[model samples]
Target: MEMIYLDNAATTPVLDEVVEAVADCLRNYFGNPSSLHRLGIRSEKLIKEAADSVGAVLHVDADEIIFTSGGTEANNMAILGTALARQRTGRHLITTAIEHPSVLRVFDHLKSQSFEVTYLPVDKSGLISPDRLEKEIRPDTTLVSIMHVNNEIGSIQPIEQLGRIIKSINPNTVFHVDAIQSFGKLGLYPKKWGIDLLSLSGHKIHAPKGIGALYVKKGVRLQPILFGGGQQRGYRSGTENIAGIAGLGAASKFIRRELETKSAYLYDLKNRLVAGLKDALPQAVINGSLESGAPHIVNIGFPGMKGEVLLHALEDEGVFVSTGSACSSRDRTVSHVLKAVGVDDRIAGGSIRVSTSYLTTMDEIDAFISILASVVSRVEKYSRR
Candidate 1:
């Protein structure tokens, strides 16, 4: 059976161009960026070029970008680093109920350190109300962290609106957006959006898995969480991954050039899959809004069947989806996103997330939908037994 992978939200396959770029870097640019010698200068130049690629796409100053291992580190750097740096300003912070574990867990850690945290709840459609957020902001609020796109349900939050509200309420408050799942798929201007910091992962945009970046607005103060030789202008200290950085830069350029075309293509595929699943399983309830959610992702709950059962059944036919975020899939827990949007545990447990990539084809969608329909039917039969 031909495999149809529809879990791009978890991670995407590296493009051939990205692979070549990485190989070239590994083969030739092996010097540490921290050195002042010619080889080291070449590596540092490569890092600068990569930062330029990402910065150009985001319309920000290249110097403001800091390279890290991936989204988790970027997020940790933005959240923990900012809180620690600005804790003297205030110890109160705000975030949403549906952020990725990286952001949420960091907030949890902050709470232990005596930082007051307010987790704003989302509506049934997984949207945070700007008005509600305005009410939550306090005089002491120092940091506001929210995700641009939800990894689980693919819900697009009103990040710009939230940023405006947070900034208007407190100019000193640092606004951070976790754009791991949205950066390449959506056009984001951190400066224009009033975002003080934005996190991005290369793997989500078909780059190598180990590289990601954080956009720190010029003049924003962040204490370095990782102590080392003070690389990345003393923001993130480490020996840079030259190959991964090269791949990230190549991927950023590719995605920036292809974003509009790729997004429309994936949106069309998502619609076809959703329509087919509905036609085959009328009992299936989509977990989030069809019109407002990200075009590549659709979450559907087969009312009487467990999502895990349907997931493996589809995998048996070489069609892959997910119960939710791949990070939490193995935990066998109900999706917190669905629950935040008021989905019952039963339906949340039965929901599967089908996320397409720029590389997914219409034929793959058709085959996956056909297999999914069959799997849901069979699982429902077994549930009735």
Candidate 2:
């Protein structure tokens, strides 16, 4: 049985080119980016070139991009750093209830410090109201953090509009976006979108894990999160992960060249799976707004089935998907995103998230859907017994 990997929202497999780039860096450019030797200069140059590659994708200045471990750290640095830097100016912040844990938990930590945080509720579509967000922003509101694409339900937030709302309401209030899931699959223009800080993860776009970046608009001051060797202009300190950075750069360039084509292909695959599932299981309910969701992700719920049972059943057929964000898959917590979008706890329990990548195939989608129908049938039979 050929394995069909559809849980891309959790993580994507690294591309062969990315793997070679990382290996090449590890073998040939194995110098510390902070060292003063000639090899170090080459490694440092590699870092700069990689930054430029990622920067081009965001349409931002290369100097504004700061490398970090991954999306979580990028989100942490943006939220915590901005709140700390602007605390004297304001102790109030705003975010959505459906943000990835990285952004939500950071706000929770700040709340413990007496910062007032207002969480915007999503409609059935898993989207925050711009008017509500604008009303939350005040002269003293320090920052607003939102994710571009939801990791669970695949809802695409109106990030550009929300960014405009935050800036228009209070120019001093910084806007941070966790674009980890949307970076390579969608168009992200920080400057045009009025985004002050945008977080990205390399692994989401076929680059290696353990490397990501934060785009801090020039003149936006954020307190340093890491203290070491005074690297990354004192924003994030530590010896740079040279190999990972090289892989990220390689992935960014490749994605940039293929983005338009890749996006169309993903949409084709997603639509095929959705259509197939509906035809096979008429009672299957999609969790998010089909009109506004990302092209690479889809969430479906079986009215009378448990998600885990269906998930494991699919696994037996060489197909893989997830119950929710891989970061919190095993927590046994109610799906916060589904709850926010008004999914009953029982139906939410039956929800599965199927995410695709550029490499996913139409044939794989068809096979998974056929396998899923069979699995659901067998599970239903056992349940009726």
Candidate 3:
């Protein structure tokens, strides 16, 4: 049986076009971008062109994009760099309780160094209220970091509204957004959204792993986390991953060209999957605010079954899904995102996230639903025994 992959949120398969781009770069553009020779110039041109492509997709200047080793590094650089740079101005930061470990861990690290952090709570729908945020703003608050979309639950955050609130309260406070899950899936215009720093991952959108970009609005002040040759405008150092960067560019271009069509297709797929699951298992509950989420993901909870048992049983039947974000899968802890959204411990532990991509097919989704229904039925039966 062919395995049906429903874990696009963890990482997507590199598209054929992106793979070809990377392979071509590896074959022909191996020279160090820093060298002053013809080979180096060729490599440098490719890197710059890649940056330009990604920047064009987001409607930003190429100079504003700094390449990093995927979203984690970009998040670290954005939060840490901004916090450290603005330390003299203020030492207070604000973020949500449902942020990815990358952002949360960076704030944790800052807390260790004497910076004060306020982790704002989310509502039952996994949303942070702008009014609550307004209440949390302090004279000393220097930065507000939030994710554009919740990774596990697929709930869309009110980024533009939140940005306006933050700007109104503290114009000097940098507003950074982790758009790793939303960049390609949603319409993301950092300038229009009033975002000072934005983090995006290539791997999340069919680009090769190990390449991502951080969009630093032109006037934003950020301290360098890495030191070496003055690459990435001296913000991020070391030699650029020419091939991976090229692939990222290609991936961004692909998404720009197909975003609308793919988004609609994904919406249809999600609706079909959710409807099928609901019809087949009435006890199953769809979590999160469906109307306010990205159309490509569905988080569902089976009332009497462990999510891990269902996950492995589906895997055994050639269906692949996730209990939560791949980065936190090893911990076996209930999803922090679900808990933040007020899901009871019993239901939260039984929640599984099924995320789709533009490449996922309806047939595969149906197959997954068939297998999942059977798996949940078996688990429910076993529970009685």
Candidate 4:
């Protein structure tokens, strides 16, 4: 049987155009970008062009883009760099309960160094209220980091509204958004939304795995996370991954060109999947807000069976899914995102996330549902025995 891959929220397969771009860079642009020779100049120029292409997608200047080793590094650079730089001004930060480990772990690290962090609670739909954020901001609050879309549940956070609230309460406070999941899927107006720093991952959008970018508004101050020859305008250091950068640039252009039609297609697929699940297994409970969620992800739970058990069963049938964020899947713990949204232990433990990509087709989705219904029935039957 042909494999039906549905775990796109973890990572996407690199595109053919992106592969060609990377190969061209590796074959021809072998000189170090920092050298004074013609080959170095050519390499530097290629990187600059890539930056411009990626920046165009976000409506920001090329100077604002800092390439890093994917979303974890981007989020770390934004959180740690900003906190250390602004510590003299204030030592307080704000974030949500359901943030990815990259953002939450940074906060935990800062807390060890005497920073105060307020983790705002989410509603049953995995959403934070702007009013609650307004209440949390203090004159000493230095940063507020939030994700544009939840990686596990696909809940769309009110980023623009929260941005406005953060600025209104504390204009000096820096607002950092992790847009790794939403960058290519939805429209992002960082400037208009008052976002000071934004993080994105190339792998999430069919670019190479070891590359991503952080958008830093022109004057936002951030201390360096790495030190060496001052690459990325001294924000991130070390030699640039020329081939990965080229692939990232090509992928950004591709996604921008396809965003409109691709999003519509994924939305239709999601609706069909949700409806099919409800019709086939009425006992399954959806874990997040379906109406306001991202177009490609649907997280649901079968009350009595374990998600990992079902996931393996589906894999046996050549259907791939996930229990939660791929980064946390190895921990053997229930999803923190599900618990934050008030899913009880029983349901959260049994939840699985099925995420699609623009490349996914309707036939594959129908086949997945047909196979999933059978798997759930078998697992639940075994449990009752």
Task: Pick out the ten consecutive residues of candidate 3 with the lowest summed lDDT.
Answer: 257-266
RMSD of each: 1.2, 0.9, 1.1, 1.0
Q: Count clashing pairs, candidate 2.
A: 0
Per-candidate TM-scores read 0.98, 0.98, 0.98, 0.98
- Separate clash counts for every candidate: 0, 0, 0, 0
Per-residue CA lDDT of model 3 for 1-385, tens digit only, reads 4789899999999999999999999999989999999999999999889989889878899999999999999999999999999999999999999999999989989999999999989888889888999999988898999999999898899898999899998899899999999888888888888899999999999998889999999989999999999887899999998899999999998998877556588889988887888788788887888888888778898765688888888888888889967779988888888889988878888888999998899998888877887888888888899
- Tens digits of lDDT, candidate 4, 1-385: 4999999999999999999999999999999998999999999999999999889889999989999999999999999999999999999999999999999999999999999999989999899988899999999999999999999999999888899899988999999999999988888999999999999999999998989999999999999999999987889999999999999999999988877556587889998998888899899999989988998888888776798999999999999999977779998888889889999888888889999988888989899989999999888888888
User: How accurate locally, in lDDT, is each candidate?
Assistant: 0.88, 0.90, 0.90, 0.92
Please, what are the lDDT tens digits per residue for candidate 2 over residues 1-385?
4799999989899999999999999989988888899989999999999999999999888899999999999999999999999999999998899999889899999999999999999999998898888888889999998899999988999888887888888999999999998999888999999999999999898998899999999999999989888999999989998898999999999889878556587778878987898799898999988889998889898886899998999998889999967779998887889989999877889889999988888888888878888899999999999
Clashing pairs in 2: none
Best-fitting candidate, scored by lDDT: 4
lDDT of 4: 0.92
> Which residue runs of candidate 1 sit more than 4 Å off their true CA positions?
none
Off by over 4 Å in 2: none
So what's the TM-score on candidate 4?
Answer: 0.98
Model 1, clash count? 0
What lDDT, from 0 to 1, does candidate 3 have? 0.90
Expressed as tens digits, the lDDT of each residue in 150-232 for candidate 1 is 99888898777777888888989999999998888888988878999999999989998889999999999999999989999
List of clashing residue pairs for candidate 4: none
